[model samples]
Structures are given as structure tokens and as C-alpha cells.
Target: MRATVNQGPVDIDCRPTLPNITVMLYKDGQQIIPDFDKILPIQKKGFLLNDVSFEDSGIYYCQANNYTRTIILTVQDDSTYLSEPEIQIPSNTHFVLGSPFSLLCMLNISKNMSQSNTKLEWVLPPSAEV
Candidate 1:
């Protein structure tokens, strides 16, 4: 089976006897598969995939013993035209006076999602007058 992770060395988490396999990771036409130090499949059954991220998005597949399974990952940008973040502004929030401030920009591909996919943006206060 195919697997993926955030931008980093390619990692695998499968069985030791799963027959040392090689997988590929990609992003915007670039490949980021690590040469060594990949996570081996847990020696036990029922493995869980933790910590999913944007750069970790892509397609994965494995062909072993003449059999195959595929995994697909879709990484949505924070500013998708197909959904919210459609308007670039905060919703009824407070701002401090005479202090530097910022907005947390979250481009929601869906209305039901939040935080995990957002990035922070900083805004500086106007300079003090003489």
C-alpha cells in the first residue's frame, strides 16, 4: 500500500517481513522520498496513521505478491476559491489599539473544518506619530 507524510524524509510503517519495499512521495511535481531512516510498519496489526499535513498530500500505492492497494491524499490550499476564506476577513473579533496585531488565515476547503489547516498572518500597527 502507498503512504505519505508532511514534507520530510520518506517514512514507512509496515511489518519487518513485509519485504523491504520502496515508496515515492511527491509535491507539485517534485519528489521528496528519503533514502534511509524510513519508519517500518509496526510489527503488529491494526496500525494507525497519525499527524497528517498539507505537504503530506499525494497518491500512494503498493504492489506486492502480485496484489495492489492504493492511497490517495488531497492537500487543499488555505485559500481555495471553491469555499470559505472566500472572503479574507475575520468574523467579529477584537483588535488591540497601538499594538502590533495579526490575523489567523484559515483557508477552508470545507465549512466544517478549522485550525489544523490554517496559517498565521501578522499585521503591524501604524507607526506612532511625533
Candidate 2:
């Protein structure tokens, strides 16, 4: 999964355990770990990188003997493109006695639906009819 900067301790897995597992981690083309930690293989068969930053974004490679796995890691800024919605519910309304009263509620999701696949709905009161 892609993570934002300062958002994670990313774990890259090392697969195909041998009798003696010696895993090495590489980022881009440079090696990160020369020697595997003693407890890494026993604990999770992976490496946990704490508080990843933008500089940590690259193609990660896990090499253990001949078996290897590669992953593309993209780090993004925490800023969001969408702002809080401005809700405008009427503050005051007056109706005469025995007069029919109707209320309308509207929600705008135009900015939030660009990348979303989920649906949004508003439920009406049980006594209300459309």
C-alpha cells in the first residue's frame, strides 16, 4: 500500500524461507541492509521501516539468495485536495397554525466523488413521504 510521509513503518516481506535465511533490502539501486537482523526472520519475515519520508520513495527490492520480490513505493504529502463542505441549513422559519410545513435537505459531494466508487444516501423520516 502507498503511504504518506511520516505515516508509517512500512514492512517489506521476505519470502521462501530456507534453512538459513539471509535477506537483504535495497532501495532504487542502493542497498539498505547489508546483514539481516537476527529477529527479523523469526518475527515477521520482513523489515519494518519507521516513519518513512519522501526520500524513502523508490522501488524496494527484497533479496534472499535467489528468491527476490520487488515493489514500487510512492510517498505523498499529507495535504488533501478537498475542503470542508459549507452546509446552509435555514436557521429560522415561520408557519401559520395548521399550515403544511416542508423541509428540504441537500448535501453536495461534487468535490468528493471524483475518485470514489461508494454511493451516498440520505434516509427520510418514517412519517415523511416523497
TM-score of 1: 0.30
For 1-130, candidate 2 gives per-residue lDDT tens digits of 3433435766666554764677777888788853343213334456766666677788888887878888777765344223344445457878667777665644344443554653445667999655
Output the lDDT of residue 95, model 1: 65
* Model 1 regions lying over 4 Å from their true place: 1-40, 44-50, 76-130
TM-score of each: 0.30, 0.50
Residues 51-72, model 1: lDDT tens digits: 4456456665433444444556
Give the clashing pairs for model 1.
2-61, 5-56, 10-34, 12-39, 13-40, 13-41, 14-40, 14-41, 78-107
Scored by Cα lDDT, where does model 1 land? Answer: 0.44
RMSD of each: 14.3, 9.9
